[model samples]
Target: MTPDLFGRHRAVLPDWLALYYEDPLEITHGEGRHVWDAAGNKYLDFFGGILTTMTAHALPEVAKAVGEQAGRILHSSTLYLNRPMVELAERVACLSGIPDARVFFTTSGTEANDTALLLATAYRRSNTILAMRNSYHGRSFSAVGVTGNRGWSPTSLSPLQTLYVHGGVRTRGPYAHLDDREFTDACVDDLKDLLGHTRAPAALIAEPVQGVGGFTSPPDGLYAAFREVLHERDILWIADEVQTGWGRTGEHFWGWQAHGQNGPPDIVTFAKGIGNGMSVGGVVARAEIMNCLDANSISTFGGTQVTMAAGLANLAYLLEHDLQGNARRVGGLLLERLRAVAARVPHVREVRGRGLMIGVELTRPGSDEAAPEAASAVLEEARAGGLLIGKGGGHDTSALRIAPPMSLTVAEAEEGAAILERALRSV
Candidate 1:
């Protein structure tokens, strides 16, 4: 159906089927960082499908790979090994620096996390799973159980052993004064105490940089501290790189690398950009941890032929063009521009992020209000001005997330920033 027709029908659709809180624009086509709606309005897409399309939309190389693979073979069950699947797995392992790693692919990030949780629990024969507060892993039962966000739960909690820790540096300017280092140390000590009291946790799951948690980067030494603590208790560290992996963070191919070389996680989960928007997710476990899983644990459609082809082509394009370098350069430029804009807007409390993943926090002038309404107003204004961004955090917390594709050019980033400036001004 046409975009207009779909919109009209959507207006009358049941609330359950149409549960979108924010109004969505009808996008007709997208290329690189821009999308055109049915009414011929074009938008600078900073969201990039919530960071899923790292290579950008309608990439010719990825499209070609998908087409070529489709003509030859599409589905090859787990019982059989396919060339594309083997190549994709090898490429992921090589890039992740986890030699001898085994990959079990899934169609989405949620499934990837689900699989990782199960694998960690079963391998260690431990019941406790430790995760960070404000972290978003996925929506599956086990994933939700470990996720600290209670908003995601609709029914009784799952019976998984879980502990939630707090992450994020506290700055005096944005809110009340607090020592970030002290807060981090306290959290670590709490974790150590918890570990001492309960059976050792099966795994410690965390987003290298908290994606859904205000895009907050942990305290400088928090990762290393957590690694040391978890190791002391014999717990595996699971880095959920779903939104931060595949060069999105620039300097490192994976966000975990940002934690320092000594903090390499035991297992890393990836999804968003691996297939360049195709439905593919998986975990790269260290050889020892991976060895614990046998043929009994497998997914029939995990690494399908078509998905693997797309993933392999995406990775090849990323490496061949040095997309990570572009992400760093462009991300730095974007952050500088955003900070400049924030300086002019009193409501903009902070501008923070690493690489292409950014967040602009808004607050009421001289008041404690998080100014979530101001953020919503800015979002709507930006949408009207042909720019697409996203909102996160409970209470709407006044944070707008920006995660454009790696293929986005400097010119495009500038245009998006300009559009955002106008939107902020209107608000």
Candidate 2:
């Protein structure tokens, strides 16, 4: 008999790790945008494993690449020549839009952002970082220090001083009622005012779309405006594209592309989806900035051959299939469907997002107060309805996150939307 240690694994797992649902799911396998639990219950996976499965689950191209590479070699350290890593790096550097770009690989988004912080601080010679309010970067010390959300931030202990800035969330804060142009101006004015009092800082890092912040984002061109201000002051701009990169947003190949008036950011960090669920995270920057450190550095497992092969294949599939276009069409339909449902549901705050990345904010029926309980109920309800979704918010967990695989079809979107409608209304 098989040694089924699943129960023991759960019991002994770290207390810090939060499992979803009252009865946690055990995903045996997946295909396309659907998965099956240990009990063989099928679920239309709207979250796509937190958007890591960018193209599809069990993608044949990626699987073949991984298998072929693993059979040849698995763990060649970054110290050696890795062809797949180099190939993937070339593609990312070209796509990043940063002139004279250099690429560095890491195993996770936390490590990628940590590396970017190191590059910015070292190159600019300042330990200070500017992050948007209600934004989340990662869980590392440097990453968490710059995170402006209270719920996701676990500790205040940080080596660098992080100044919280505005203009990340469009539908919240004092400027929520303002129009797009007015809101942009207010946030810019506030940013200028903040800069006047503080000492010189290294960079202003932001996610064009705040993933864990409930899929929130400022109006278009806000970051370009911010970049203009930062440029004059010689402050670097880092776009944390961990969740928003690789055409997930539909209208743009990169989220920062939507704010291209001032051109690309000084640096860009990417992860989650490029590998189609493989652990692949990296930073792209101007060669000068990336090469600023005099001492030598290399990641032990950052660009392992196997992961790079998977990423190369997955990225190829995404580009070849024009899945970005699919995301645009399917996601627009899904968004419209959800919005129609939200219009009828009293507690539904807003259905917002572009492409496959969408968020439905839940609130109390009669009040502006965050209704996390409602969101949780909706999540459980969706699961029971044979759909899997996720949740986050500027407020403690009041937004439902919907990010199906990029390959989600029109029929699947309709099916998932119908299930979600019932879940939201019932909850």
Listed in order, each prediction's TM-score against the native is: 0.92, 0.98
User: lDDT tens digits, residues 1-427, model 1?
Assistant: 2557657767888553532125555678988778897778887888887788889788899999999989998897888868888888888887787657777788888998887887798789887899887678887888888876555544547768788766643442222254766766776777787777877789999887777656777756677788888887778888899999988988788888866546578888999888888899998897677778666765778899999999988888988998899999999999999999989988888898888989888889766567888888988898888788887654355788899988879998899999999998877
The list of candidate 1 runs beyond 4 A from truth reads: 1-23, 169-183, 395-397
Task: Tell me, by TM-score, which candidate is best.
Answer: 2
Q: Ten-residue segment with the worst summed lDDT in candidate 2?
A: 1-10
> How many clashes in each structure?
0, 0
Report residue 136 deviation for candidate 1 (angstroms): 0.3
lDDT of 2 at 273: 90
Position 131, candidate 1: lDDT? 87
- Once model 1 is optimally superposed onto the true structure by TM-score, how far is the C-alpha of residue 213 displaced, in angstroms? 2.0
